[model samples]
Target: MRVIDKFKMFSIGPLVPSAFSDGNDPKDKSFGCELFDKSEKNYHQWLDSRPEGSVVYVSFGSLAVLKKEQEIEILRGLLESERPFLWTRRKGEDEGKKKNLEYDDVIIDEKLGLIVPWCSQMEVLCHKSIGCFVTHCGWNSTMESLVSGVPIVGYPQFSDQTTNAKMLEEVWGIGVRAKEVEGIVKREELKRCLGILMENGEKGEEIKRNVKKWRILALGAVKIGGSSHDNLKKFIEGL
Candidate 1:
């Protein structure tokens, strides 16, 4: 709600990229360094090989780190869910600060999962194979997942993330928040949340439907002649 003041305020935007847009591009906006682009495996091809809505995508973003125990729980949970997953653990982490935990060294069955240092996040989220995201609940990631119509398993670390998780789960009804004990989200709990999202259950289906609804709504708002597009045009005309 905008307050009535001397300066007018008009709501405009949620300009999601082409995955959820009627834009000309067949892809969402992508900008990344060539190093990540030239990774050994074609991550995009990997995504293409999987069944639609079958992959679990996990990333803690670049800055967040888990306790060694937490990392173990997360890894086990993903395996326990028995869903194919793609996980990214940013390379060159500060090992000292991370308490000597090395995520890259962990072995995963190639058939079950793949771990990479970096990839195009927006592109990954937009891919049809992504059924769910295990994320830190950062705002950008949250929006990308919603636009892609993928559900979430929020493992928020700090700041606005906690609140963002609440909105994603409680307000939007699009996902579930992992319960933690002594600052650690246990393996069983993580697996339980994953099941709630990926299993053929009432809650899972509801969340999927809600996220799909948001995707359509977001796409509708940004298309030509839509509310957001018209708002921008009107603003420009007034200038």
Candidate 2:
């Protein structure tokens, strides 16, 4: 089925809280793989050590299989920014591709960042240490960032990601999109995008303010008397 047809067939009033009830709290639920229990303790330890709003959280959702060059460039950019970061590179997503590259050389400084295969995204976003999100503009990630009050640096890959990036930068004014040259988002662009989002400049401050505004709106939507809550209640009752 075409995308529009699928949407038309299943379009109900936005039933969001069902998908986002615990967005405001990191400890409210586990948003990671239940099988990977060890990472939970490590994540909490890392989060606790960092100061509030000091870390950049980077994830390309679950399906963006980036090329080795792209991954290297992203790492270089993050390193260039000279800020602490938590980056997720899911296992099996880029398995065979990293064979030709030396992982240790790319990730030179252990103190600068933490790179994991998978993580509890919602928990990381809600953490006080997270200052900004470096994302692929996936819908769930975008909404999660919004609810967490974290501004974004969008690195859109394809499909609806471009649309989401546009909405995040142009419509919502809460993020900046990195520009790609010849299908490659260079380290310079990544650094620039992160700078725009993370700096204490006027634009960055404005984005932070906008993020807070969206966060309040998102939390309110899930609260007892909010529109989304009422809509969900009515839908359930009617059923």
Off by over 4 Å in 1: 1-7, 18-20, 23-38, 91-106, 234-239
Go through the candidates in order and give the C-alpha RMSD of each one to the true structure: 4.3, 4.9
lDDT of 2 by residue, 53-123 (tens): 88889889878888878888888888888988888777543431332224647634446777766777877
* Candidate 1 collision pairs: none
Relative to the true structure, candidate 1 has a C-alpha RMSD (angstroms) of: 4.3
lDDT of 1 by residue, 55-127 (tens): 9999888678777788788888888888888877664433312322345666565677777766778778888
Query: What are the models' TM-scores?
Result: 0.84, 0.82
| Residue pairs whose backbone atoms clash in candidate 2 | none
- What is the Cα-based TM-score of model 1? 0.84
User: lDDT for every model?
Assistant: 0.78, 0.76
Top lDDT: which candidate number?
1
